[model samples]
Target: MTTVLFVHGTGVRNPGYEETFKLIEKAVHLERPDVKVERCLWGDKLGTKLNAQGASIPLYDSTLALDEEEEDYSIVLWQQLYNNPLYELQVLSLKPGDETAGNPFGEKPGDELNSRVERLNPSTELQAKLDVAGIAEVFEPARDTVIQSEAYHQALQNASEELGEYRDAIARAIVAQAMLDCEQQEKHPPILTDAELRDEVVKLLSLALGEAELGIGDWVVKPLSQLAQPIGTFYLKRRRGIITQSVSPTPCDILLYQGRGDRIRDFIRAKIEQAEPPVVLLAHSLGGIACVDLLVQQALPPVELLITAGSQAPFFYEINALYSLEYGEPLPDYFPSWLNIYDLRDFLSYIGANVFPNKVQDVLVDSKQPFPRSHGAYWTNKAVWKAIIPRLP
Candidate 1:
């Protein structure tokens, strides 16, 4: 009889392992009843722990740090701004503005905007401002993008005779949109490293519209600054407990195994040795990493096929971080036939065929779920079962 040795991923202790293992065992027996199934449950035996109850970490459970009133909100706000150039604009538009005084004697609210809107061409002289700002490459495309965008049109309709304020807001939005465009093309420069250069780009663009960078600062950031303080304090006070409860122990297992993996590899080897001939090693996540390292370091002739699902072994090897093998090193001749299964939605899953060439066979299966969820959805996926059952030794 053939032996199928199942090695589970990180963070899987006894009760959880039993539930997941039974699912696999049932799936396998339904198809290949003649094959004997075994398990190498290493997580419970060798997983890392906070034996000192996290005493080594500074301020592990302390909340006194929240008493400090000086909270800087700019860093987090700027990070959000970098990802979404129109964040401030979106927030401002959502907010309710104070009622404007009746202007019976004045032109309608948006009339002045209609007159000047025709002249608000970002592609013309603004291109020169972008060129001097060191992102000339994205100017035309960015300009076209903003002019055609629904947000830009909406902003134009909302502007009153407050031409200066609206123009300044529009100019900054254009510049920020240009930065986002450059990033999407994977050509973002290192301008943020020199804050002066980044500021100059926005300043120069605002000056083109005969205004300054006061609109976003006075109208948008000031209000957000007030709101961020209380929110930041609430999170700060409960951060330690929140992290303790939310953060998974899986990362600890990965780190411990990467740093010192002798026990995990040895445990897998012992399982392989005791299994019947034509043994197939089926592993997932970090277990897959340990199995790959073991197979590469030493030959186990009884192990005829190796299967990995949602594994980072290939990623580690490509980064030259794998414990047993370096990047560019060929797999040993003694290594068995390898099958790697991946789900595109599972960000943890990676392709090995390109890196290992002919040695590894890569297959894709969709779990129809978003990542983190997709990572664990493979076992329930029918395609995953079909792929493995046919390849079993």
Candidate 2:
């Protein structure tokens, strides 16, 4: 007998997941009546804990917070002008599931912009070169040790703390430049991404702080970069009002899992162990991301075919949301085979192949629906079952 374990995704509270699972379960039963269907139930537990606290993930797009800039600071005016909450608003205006505008490689607009920003910021440029060139092949020998006036690393840390203020000033400067460039070209000024904003800001800081000898990509120049990731997860959920202050037992735990081996690992592990061999692990959205993290860990239960739909694993990886991958390493070769399904109409569902490369296969289907509907529509789509039936043991 094969066990099919269902894992759920983000922003789902009291989702009545069993009904959704039953849809997939019914399909599986047609193929193998004897197969056992089980749910990992991680969301239920996590949600219960969160709702008890009357908590919701804090919204993070504090472009307005930039307003508190020191007035005497020369760039204060720019900070007010460039702080962009509009990026999220603009993104929301896009029709759900509409095929994005032309980019043959199927990259999102942000990915394309990163390439342009790379020219301005060598940190990203070097990282890109290393990603394709293969990090193992790169070599740069250290110079002979020289005495230092203080702990070199700690000194770098101090410089980094001061760079935070400079980064804010720099972001405003970039926005101003973007505005000017568009005016000259007779086009509307576009929203600046954190990187494009930072790249431009770094250039400005380089000129402004020339006497301080700060350069882009310095260890001291890192812009609390890790903390920047969760805002995407939080902003997406907060905008959806997935959970409320008068919260029910249902919790959206992706925000919680952001910094943390992932929050659901232990629960999933226990359930998988009792399941029949050659198990089929099916997951949706953030649940799928959790499954990937669980499977990729050392010495975990084996899954014959891993199924995912409407997941953010690829998107999360791209945004550096996966802490395990912050350093840009590939999933282990032992990583389970993944058949990831995404509907373009579901803004949250992103492609995984380019991110996971050889380990994941991408399947596209038309949901032809809007956001909440497109994300949840997978269970009813026969195309999803067709992909699953062949993979079942």
Candidate 3:
């Protein structure tokens, strides 16, 4: 029997990533039922800022950096994650049939949510004690508690106060990091549409604003933008877990301990050692990086195979931060059999062919969605299944 360990990258996992693991297992089992699929949940090991018991944080933020230059302007890399607030406050505030204000798609200046509240009809048993109005009365205080909380006020105030500076930091981070000087950025910088600017302003005002840094040439700048973008998002998603979500001095064990993630590699190594041999390690996103780091940098026993999908190792290589390799060094001659696959739509996923040369087999899949959506699409996609089955023990 072959054991395949599925590793995850950045983002909050819904249902603690059980859905993800199951999806991958089903995808793989469709062809090979005897093979076993397991998940290495490292998202919580770092910790989270989300608190499900209190209220859902109305948190949504993404950052952009210049990627390539086009005709009149450069294209900025959009780093987006969908971590919505638990409940819809606006919907709860409105009557059951009220129409919301604006059309997001239409070319209108004003916009408001056009959704109406959907109240459930009371059951006969429940109606014995309370009428519809009585039920509404019972729930009204919960809504008030959410809106009137001191924490909510802090969140609102913090976002509003830092809005302007975060916007400046967004532009500055991109300009400084693009390897382009200030004058060059002014001349051919990426032109953002009104909607883009409006959205970025909120992101700049987001909880993640200060943690991301813009790279200025060879120098990296922090305190301007949060450089720990991935880790911050992961923390947000894992906020529902009790042990992981507690307010702490260290919000992210992964990013704060140095972006190389040695601690995670140690965990991965331990998992690998415990798994039955003839184990085929399957890693996604950051998990891929940790697995590679373990084998190359640490003295871990090699598994049967190393398969990675939607990984960011190629980008890490450019920074000379991949712990195993030296400056300009190709993949090590002793590196295990590795199969790397990626989706063209997930810009975060990079091609390793040029970097590792012939040492790595790179496969590209067409995930119709763009950007981060494509990043996790590999879990159930048929293309990913085909790639995994052939390499299994």
**RMSD, each candidate, Å?**
17.0, 21.6, 16.7
TM-score of each: 0.54, 0.50, 0.50
| lDDT by residue (tens digit), candidate 3, 58-117 | 333432333222211111222221221211222122212112322434422111101100
Cα lDDT of candidate 3 equals 0.48
Residue 215, model 2: lDDT of 30
Candidate 2 structure, TM-score to reference: 0.50
What residue pairs clash in candidate 2, if any at all? 9-287, 97-344, 97-345
Give the alpha-carbon lDDT of every model: 0.69, 0.52, 0.48
Candidate 1 lDDT tens digits, 34-76: 8888988987888776777777555555332222123244433
Clashes per model (N, Cα, C within 3 A): 0, 3, 14
Can you rank all candidates by TM-score, best first?
1, 3, 2
Candidate 1, poorest ten consecutive residues by summed lDDT? 62-71
Question: How big is the positional error of residue 140 in model 1, measured in Å on the Cα after superposition?
Answer: 60
- Model 2 off-target regions past 4 Å? 10-13, 48-251, 259-263
Candidate with top lDDT is: 1
Off by over 4 Å in 3: 11-16, 47-254, 257-260, 299-302
